[model samples]
Target: MDAIDEHIVSLLRSNGRASFSAIGREVGLSTNAAAVRVRRLESSGVITGYQAILGTDAPDGVAGLEAFIDVRLEPGRDSEEFLVWASGTRDVLDAVHVTGPYDYLLRVRVRGTAALDGFLRLLKREAGAAQTQTRLALRPSAAGASARERF
Candidate 1:
């Protein structure tokens, strides 16, 4: 994928339901061109499935818990292999390689404590995570808010 494809992916990540026409306008492409690119991305497995997010006030399922987990891989484990697993895992919203005690930091959302426990077990069993430290997110920063505005 090129720069235009990267931009298209970013637009879709922010709003998966955005129309091809809207994406085309943002990326300086024709509607059909945008559609073609999106189709290519889907076929290439870069664009996964999309889903609806129920609001907190909604009468159905409760808003999920968000947390960050610092992961240390097992001895002689492959970082690339772990990354592949992280990318495919549904609850792992973001994974970053960072300079720290841990090899990676993952941002995730799950139903509740039981679901969180299950995910942790899966991470250790399937992803080769040797150690992990977790922190619950009390709240997220406001969208489009700058550092100065955040405080």
Candidate 2:
């Protein structure tokens, strides 16, 4: 990808709903040209998908909690099974297989501590996790912030 393509990606990352015209204006391309470039990025798997960033409070006025769960699988456990289960889980926002002390890192969202506790119990019982460490996120950085700034 060229510099223009990179810039388009940055714009899209910050605002996935940005119009082609807006992207074109920012990147010095015509609207059609910007749309074509975005299509190319999508076809090449550079842009896999778009997602909405939810606030701490939902539209229904319920506050949500976020947590990161570090899980270590038992020896001889089927890692694929755990991965598949985590992927299909409703409260699991994201799961990554990592090269570290933990076998997987799970980002979870729930309504309350009771819900989190229930989810953790289910994960341990069903996923065969030998151990787990859960850390509640006190606050998340602004969604519009760049990755470097958030980190």
Candidate 3:
């Protein structure tokens, strides 16, 4: 990709809904030229797809819930294997091995209570979790609230 194409990709990464005319103006191309290049990028799979990112609110406009689960693996279950599985699980945001009664702690977000129940069932059935203790987060603390901003 040329410099203009790189710039276009950068712009689109920041705002996927940017118009061809806006991209053209920023990249010094005509609107038609920008459209053609963007189409080329799409066809070539450089721009695979676009998606709408949901905020803290759920798709239904209700606020989602966050919880932390303390997990104890089944007898002879491998910690590395559990870590890998937890990493791949969609709702699991963070998993850490800690020195405590539990083997691992998992931070998760779910749309509602039903989703949380389903996730716990899946964890026990597929992830080899023998026991779990869960606590819901009422709100983010000062540090928790600013954690994402640091990134």
Inter-residue clash pairs, candidate 2 = none
What is candidate 2's lDDT per residue for 1-151, written digit by digit as tens?
A: 9999999999999999999999999999999999999999999999999976545743345457889999999899999999899988888888999988999999988878888999989988898989999999888656799888887
* Leading candidate by TM-score: 1
Ranking by lDDT: 1, 2, 3
- Candidate 3 lDDT, tens digit per residue, 76-102? 999999999999987888999988899
- Flag regions of model 1 displaced more than 4 Å: 1-62
| lDDT for predicted candidate 3 compared with the true structure | 0.89
C-alpha TM-score for every candidate: 0.58, 0.56, 0.55
lDDT of each: 0.90, 0.89, 0.89
The backbone clash count of each candidate, in order, is 0, 0, 0
> Between 1 and 3, whose TM-score is larger?
1
Off by over 4 Å in 3: 1-63, 144-151
lDDT of 1 by residue, 20-88 (tens): 999999999999999999999999999888866533332344577788999999999999999999999
Looking at model 2, report the run of 10 residues with the lowest lDDT sum: 53-62
